[model samples]
Target: MSVWFQSTGRKMNNSSEGQLDKICESLSQAELVAMIELQLSEVDMLQSMFPDPRELVVEDPSVLCDLRDFAEGRTLLLPPHLDLIINLNVGKGRLSMSANLPHHYPAVQPNIFVRSQTLNRDAQHRLNQELLGYLKMLQQGDLCIGPAVTWLQEKGETFFDDHPEEVTKSDANTMETKVIKFARLWIYSHHIYSKVKRKDILDLSREFDLTGFCLPGKPGIICVEGLSRNTEDWWHKVRSWNWQKILCKKLEENELKAEEDISKYRRFSVFEELGSENNIRVKSGGFHVDMGDVFKYLENHESGYVFKEYFGISGRAT
Candidate 1:
């Protein structure tokens, strides 16, 4: 009787194993289908939101073709993993975001990297850390890139303000001692609508102890006067950024006298942004500076002669 019961138990176990295999196979296929659908939907949404080719660039062009084929039912194979870069014009700043989505994403979080021209090293690190923290708080299957971008557009500027670059006392003293020659540089750009560029201009001026003003608009104008070497270094850094066109329009250098007050030789005491109140108006795309106001400001500071050098005109009349 024991042998009979044992034989029946073995047969029952074999039948259960066959049924379990079928169930597992079914579940695996369903999971794969679901994953594919999720990925396709997300990619479509992302592409739709950032319609510009420049704004949303695909790292691997083949992946885009594969996705297209799969979506159109021309292939049974799943689309390849996707790597995307999104260029964003966040509130007065610019951000370049890279997102990598694996085969099982939405089931897993994407790897993300954010780059900015405006943020300093420490600020960049803090921004990335906070973004990682934000991802951790989200559910595993939740879509995060959109929210991440929203967070950046809304709060990224805070990080810039929060992490002010520090200049050591020794560095400041060294910079002061290095100022044997006083120099002023006038830089011109096609346009400067980016807040990131503006912030960088401000930060670099502070680092170099430059005193000047930036007129941001259709024809962006920047003037920085300080130690010759520092001004050169600052210009080198600024010109390296992506721009339609940028040029050192004018350069003025003079040897400092022993009793000369740097203040008397400098037109501006601090770096500042000249805006609408200063006769610079924002039009649909860029800024329009009433040359009269600019000439007036420069004339007040005894630096009005630059108008002729910059515009080839004697004054605002021309």
Candidate 2:
């Protein structure tokens, strides 16, 4: 019975292999050659347009060799995908784009990754999403990289224009003494692994000029302190975002006598993500913040008592 089963399995495997060969044979060699030619021509055009070797990097040069081999009929299968990293000057900063062309590239959309130091992570994410949406609207077999670059060159600066520096500048220019109501919020979440969520947290905090820190990992902790209105707005926006489990664990509010008195109520000078610092030990496999580091941070800030509020433990012994 075992020998009969083995023979049946071998026959099934041979049938599948034969079907794969038939599919490969059905693909037009001429069409494959045309795709390779188009890709090669596009690479040349990109190099010519950029005119700077530093601006473009072909991640795997072997892909080009494979293309040549397939074009010359030396190989039966299509070549591996072409990977390109392009750096472009946009506004006051540089935009780095990684474009991966799949085997049937112009017919299918390329995977795009966009990064910019000038824009915050949220802005970068929005820009990349917009670019992807633009690609999807294009007709199939469209050579897309050039148009994508053009789109970035034209509209990318808008993302950088709304930097946190603008908010800082606006605050600095205000000369009137305003009575500020301060508020601090402690938020707890089941986990904070999503890049988009982390970016949103940073962007929202900076937009509202909130100062505190976010410990992003399993059992994420967020602390934001600022003008009562701004902190409320931040919390409102945050709550609108999707979360598996999130709650406002604690809320502290106080009225500052004057703008200068804000220091008395504020515990943090800047909004930042804190789990990756030298003082913190992140658990392996996941970005888990150490409770000991959290206690130390709170102790240094003279807010160590809140550790009990966060966890039932009276101290960091657990």
- Highest-TM-score candidate: 2
User: On residues 1-318, what C-alpha lDDT tens digit does candidate 1 reach at each position?
Assistant: 001112223211112323433432433433545545666676678789889989888877887778667656677676656777888887667788777665444555666767677865445656777887987787656777787887887877676543233544444556556547789999888888888679978987887679999998877889999877668656755764546678888999998865477776787889988977655544555567667878878887788888887789887631
Distance from true position, residue 263, model 1, in Å?
2.2
Q: Give the clash count for each candidate.
A: 1, 0
Residue 129 in model 1: lDDT: 76
RMSD in order of candidates? 19.5, 13.7
List lDDT for all candidates, in order: 0.70, 0.72
Estimate the lDDT of model 1: 0.70
* Stretches of candidate 1 exceeding 4 Å from the true structure: 1-179, 258-260, 279-286
Q: Estimate, for each residue in 1-318, the C-alpha lDDT of model 2 and write its tens digit.
A: 001112223211112323433533444667557556677777888988887778988876788888878878898777666878799998787898877665444544556767765665446657877887887777656778888999989988877755588866665566355445789999998888878679879987997779998888878889999878677656755764445578889999887663466767788989998865637777886586578877888888778888888788865722
> For model 2, what is the C-alpha lDDT against the true structure?
0.72
